[model samples]
Target: MSEARNTFGKTSITQKSKKLQPRVDLTAMVSVSFLLIVFFMLSSFLSRSNAMDFGMPDKRHIDCGTEPYCLGEDRLYTVLVGINKIVCYEGNRLDFSNETRSFKFNDNLLIKEMISKNQFLKNFYGDKKGLIVIIKPSKESNYGNLVDVLDEMAIVKVPTYAVVDITPEEEKLLADK
Candidate 1:
């Protein structure tokens, strides 16, 4: 816009306002922002589910005719994976005769216990086949605990371990404790 002096030093006529383009170009900014968004979207890692190097037990040997599960009570060890704790015993049932041991989540006590048990069995029976383990996790047990217990089995080189449901008697035993 411009001002023109009319008569007595007074401004009267003026040019129309010119539309000046913005000096800062936002094209670079928009492109940079889009590139950043794309970078993050592509670089971010998606959470993938993982499992132990264990497979389903063979159905061939699960033929304890009358019983719901495999029998061989003497070789079977029961591990009850509870909330932040493991209640374990070496037998089919959590009974009076068999002693039970409980370990916390921290310090890897469960692993140690399993290792000791394995050593004991190896020394006593002089065979790895005798240590059959049945793992039962309560609803309170988390996925990590289950994985830890399974990992401990691998660490102890346990030949036979089965993840199973807790019987009513076993649940009652846990409730009592």
Candidate 2:
């Protein structure tokens, strides 16, 4: 609201002088400011990114003799993620005869197995980095199981690991369990 007042007592023609104070309406500006704040807050919260970092094998052929990072059969640790159980084995071959060990997703046995294998490698190779984990999630396994396995790898501080496609033989092994 603006008020008008007579600044001068009288004008030359006996007319009173008037002065009006300026008024500014800031209701729209304040509303827009609040709306913008809310919009930015929501956008920032929704746009936040969540991710996990892991190495992927190179597409090109890698020679074990030449490449220092090349994984050998003795250092290979394969994990098969199933619907209710996780099967793990050390070495390149997936031998169910005696090597394949199964553990439930909720149990810490898988973590123990990984740690033991990592320790075994560290002891045998006398190297700081040795274990190379390869995760194969079956179709029956959910995304959560895969995430859990990756988390276990992180927990164990495994030097190298990768998520790979499951082969038909491995899938059959999982189904037989």
Candidate 3:
């Protein structure tokens, strides 16, 4: 009886020694991670598409054609778009010295402030009937950033607009062209 019990225990030990290593299945995890990456990429693309695009008006628009816009009291507003600042002027000549820097439009607060200001400008100018807003952007500025500024201007309901202060002197000398 003892020998039979010993033989059974030895067989049990032999079976236990031939154990298989535990393996983790990474196939499902890899697939899920890949799907998540693809989803994020697609979502980013879609969000970019929703961003506003503002293109500079053609030179023809600035010409004023047959009937030129009148420059009168309460009729024209000048806007200056600098590298890191935006300021509004009451007339053609903007005073950078006494400039109201705090009220200037910035990338962070541009949209919110511009929308409210547009409503104000619309009513402000509508009281007088007609107005022209001129935009002056720096030469080194990015076109897209310029458009962002213009989009804000448009949101404020600025009717007639123009772009000036671009450096033709530098553009003509560019070797890349």
Instruction: Give the best candidate by lDDT.
Output: 2
Of 1 and 3, the candidate ahead on lDDT is 1
Residue 149, model 2: lDDT of 92
Task: Order the candidates by TM-score, highest first.
Answer: 2, 1, 3
Rank all candidate structures by their lDDT, best first, as comma-separated numbers: 2, 1, 3
lDDT, candidate 2, residue 28?
100
Tens digits of per-residue lDDT, candidate 3, 120-165, equal 6568766444446666666655676567677766666655667766
Instruction: Name the weakest run of 10 consecutive residues (lDDT summed) in model 2.
Output: 61-70
Q: Which regions of candidate 1 fall more than 4 Å away from where they truly are?
A: 1-51, 57-71, 127-130
lDDT of 1 by residue, 81-175 (tens): 88878788878766689888777878677777777777777888887454778899887788899988888888888978888777777776665
TM-score, per-candidate, Cα-based: 0.60, 0.66, 0.42
Regarding TM-score, does 1 or 2 come out ahead?
2
| lDDT comparing candidate 3 with the true structure | 0.56
Local accuracy by lDDT, each model: 0.77, 0.84, 0.56
Q: Write the per-residue lDDT of candidate 2 for residues 1-177, one digit (tens) a residue.
A: 899888588556676668789899999999999999999999999998877786777766555775444568778888999998988777655654548888898799988878888899899988776789889999999988888999999899898898878989999988877
When 2 and 3 are scored with TM-score, the better candidate is 2
Candidate 2, lDDT over the whole model: 0.84
